[model samples]
Target: MRDEIKGIRPPSNPAAIKDALDDIARIRGRPLVYPFIGSGRGRGALVELADGSVKWDWITSIGTHFFGHGDPEMTRAVLTVASADVPIQGHLQPNGEYVEFLRAVSSIAPGRCKHVWPSMSGTMANENALKIIRQRHAPAFRVLAFENAFAGRSALMSEISGSAANKKGQPDMGQAHPVPFYDPADASSVDRTVAAMDDAFKKHPGEFCAMHVELVQGEGGFRDAPREFFQAVFERCRRERVAVWVDEIQTFGRIGEYFMLTRLGLEEWADVVTIGKMLCGSAVLFSSEYNPDPGLVSGTFAGYTAGLALGAHVIRRLRADGLIGLQGKIRALERAVSERLQVWKSDRLIRDYTAVGAMAAFTPIEPDLDSIRSMVRKIFDAGVCVYYTGHGPYRIRVLLPGGCMSTDELKEGFDIMERCL
Candidate 1:
């Protein structure tokens, strides 16, 4: 299996594939972020590009494809749904697969999470969560989000997101207050952040409906918000009556245990949790107290039937296999990677590294976005596909495929990364 997957090659006419991709990008009036093009062909951790080039996909569809691409079980679940001939829409007409998916999700959710509302993507899930917060806490339209945090790119979500660039031309969708996230390396970060949250409440007294946070920030450069920090913030939110909404969109299935919040022991305080990406679907899990009335959060398409089915399967496996949690395989994999990163700490080029759960980033000593981009391109040229994130001090982040890779496979990937560097 390894030989077959590793031997996969790029398309004979790589340039033609890139040209076609460029043409399509131009037609769409958008530039390609990465020159790479997908061929819709992938097996395990490898993806075949339109150019016929097969590269080890470290991004894993940006943290989707938890079990890697084209898993037999996922494919079978999808095929069964496809063969059913029933309509894919689940809001008006509930699908058995979607029902199972919700059950699985609700079971793993720390709090009651008695109410589950499915959406098509992470952004929609977050948007719907915000709607729920508004419905439950009427007259409170403002939101509290952390700086460098990412919610999504939808109209409302763009404003909620930390990046101003995502909402550059977009009109304001909601009242958002961005506070600094906790940086353990910074001695006074927690105190300052807590103070900021307090100030936001005072400035907009009774105006905030929800406090949205990514326990382990993903697109915001894979940073972690310490337990003490979260505890402190949650205390303030509780006092202010602001609903705590944990956005596990990127860190859900990939993180330690079932969810990052749960891993951090903060689920008890979270009123609503939005999850998506590798779960095969997205949904908002809220306490019964926050559950909205009918029509408050309903969508035409709850989720893809196949994806819903596969999502249920994925959740079941994660629960049964014990790949998460404190002593879980995922945690072990994270430790392994952390240890490997230490070997490069002494190297002058590598400034530092940060990881939480399956997400990690290697920071350079002297940061340069263009240099990191060049490194990524060179890494791709070296036959290992990876990506970079964050601005100014960009990092070569690793979203590991733990479900598919063993210790040896992971070490091999690390070795490849080192060679590329």
Candidate 2:
């Protein structure tokens, strides 16, 4: 695409690749996806084009590769670990890398939370959180999840998220009501809507096992929870005797001290914290020190060599290299993007703006098919990547990892985005 790109394969025909994938999609079901991203590339964080052009990645697997794709440091660990011949599904034999990952993660993720379980994905991690919550408060069938919360696609998680559409038609869709992410942006909204959650609990009696929350609701359009509000919720959950679960899958490590929960001082408050995306850089890490028993739950690829090795490398790098406290970098980026977008707000292309740590977002006033198409197409053509969330035409999200991008690179990407708006 750019005369010649550095450090990647010669590239394959994305159209041909698309055609093959299209056939698979026919059976895969045509779910409407947001624009900006075409199909992702094989290794590098580039979106492969039909003409073989590539665009920079913004989503980063919804904030998955914290360090970056194709990081040589991670590769070294992967290559060395694959030489082993143990059956990872054995469940009982979690190797040195797995043990090392857990130990480091426990030490790094708010010392108050000293336990973690390896699972397959963000959804699995969420499921584990749900399981842990119920077990901790057995008779409590309910769990408090915010309105636009985006957990994952498991049967339980889908229900908890209140996105029944995602479930499509799953038989046992567990129930969790939507609490307003708060309406500072919505003018006609009456009152400072914080009771949306309390309203839910009133409808359904003491069945709640916990209040599963995200310090930053990334999928719900990058909403930030007031720190005091989180503290209040923790105090209430204590009174209700419900477990507190924080979905750190999307927010942890984007910035702040390792896990997002710690940013809210939720380390001591959270009874269980679920982490995925960049947790071990690949595998899902769930904590259940107060709740895990041998066969209560497990995943086929839990702490496999590949994921553990990659995760270990990522964890080790953060500790050894001081990559965890990059909050200043995030603040600067948020200021740059928000200031630029504000000028365009009157143009009505933007509906809202918000930021938490390095996780950033802005939204369309009225998100529709054509509106989404125009914004994403322009961003893609200009060579940046982003994604969508919520049942609403939520926002354009950008993930700034420690090394995958430079301040200038992210700035340049946003400069192109400004022109697109």
**What tens-digit string does per-residue lDDT give for candidate 2 at 232-277?**
7677677767777778888766654577766666678877777767
TM-score of 2: 0.85
Q: Global lDDT for candidate 1?
A: 0.81
**Candidate 2 overall Cα lDDT vs. reference?**
0.65
The Cα error of candidate 2 at residue 77, in Å, is 2.3
Which regions of candidate 2 deviate over 4 angstroms? 1-15, 31-51, 86-90, 170-174, 185-205, 280-289, 326-332, 342-349
Model 1: CA > 4 A from native: 1-3, 6-16, 172-174
Cα TM-score per model: 0.94, 0.85
Return the lDDT, model 2, position 186: 73
Candidate 2, residue 54: how far the Cα is off, in Å: 2.1
